[model samples]
Target: MTKFNKIVPDDFNVPMYVNGEFFILRPLSPVYSNLDYDAVIASKEILGDIFSDNWPEGINSREDNLRYILEDYQDFQDRIGFSYIILDDEESICIGCVYIFPSLYEGSDVAIYYWFNVKFAGTYLTVKIENFIRSWVVEFWGIKKPAYPGRDIPWSEWLTRPRKKFTD
Candidate 1:
């Protein structure tokens, strides 16, 4: 089933940035059709491992890709209320990107979806991206919201691990 509603960006206009050494993320919309399509294709090429690595096969051609991006960004926009482009800061190239959307699991905070080009792996970009998203969470949802770290880790582990617990 489709994960999100398909709505235009005019309804929810809040914009935020996720900083990185090579790239920065700014809000995206259909108006930036050419740029957004280029970024999406570049992202698919760079972070294909995580982004399009497992995408259903046989989706060839630009038309197929455009349809996919339309649905993909639309779902993200509907779910997260925003989307952003992955831009290279130095040369101003579009390397790859990430997306934030409503959490699927109950009792969880917002969902943070990150996919960066392989060239960006093992860089300060990861930490900066994490910190940026953390700041966004704090600003939009408040620090009191509980975030599940995922996996089979126990609630005790999460509560006792580093950083303050949501509920004492």
Candidate 2:
């Protein structure tokens, strides 16, 4: 991961938006922070458990979420990472989020994390959504050995390995 800030190749076309039968994936701006904030807070406990991290802890305010969403959007624009807000098929409700970022470990091309609202955790749509994401990363993005640290590799093992952060 030496200076591997760009997860995909320069010629690769990063998908900014994806529309599927079950859900829609798109970058969210600060203007839609309310929807993102609502889903984040409502699914805080579950999301923390899913990621095994303390994330939505201090993000109790919509303003705080707005800043985070702005950063997410900026990351996509910069082409360093990709984060998408998963909305319902109608594109009105924020259901969850999925992220694709350069892996900090040596063996993986990229690290991916996706979580859904607790209510949709085990639902059919969630399963389909996860499949779509995995296929998109592998088939569309051409990511080999995409690391799903929490799922495929346990978080403990992943953290124990040496890190390879992006260079300045």
List ranges where model 2 is wrong by over 4 Å: 1-4
Question: Which number leads on TM-score?
Answer: 2
> Which residue runs of candidate 1 sit more than 4 Å off their true CA positions?
1-13, 16-22, 30-53, 56-59, 75-81, 140-168
Error of 1 at 57 (Å): 5.0
Q: lDDT for every model?
A: 0.50, 0.82
Q: What is the lDDT of residue 92 in candidate 2?
A: 85
Q: What RMSD does each model have against the real structure?
A: 8.1, 2.1
Worst window of 10 by summed lDDT in candidate 2: 1-10
Candidate 1, residues 68-94, lDDT tens digits: the string is: 567656655454334566666752555
Q: On residues 3-95, what C-alpha lDDT tens digit does candidate 2 reach at each position?
A: 447666678877657888878888776756898888898899887766757788879798889888888888787787888889998888887
What is the overall TM-score of model 1 with all chains considered together?
0.56
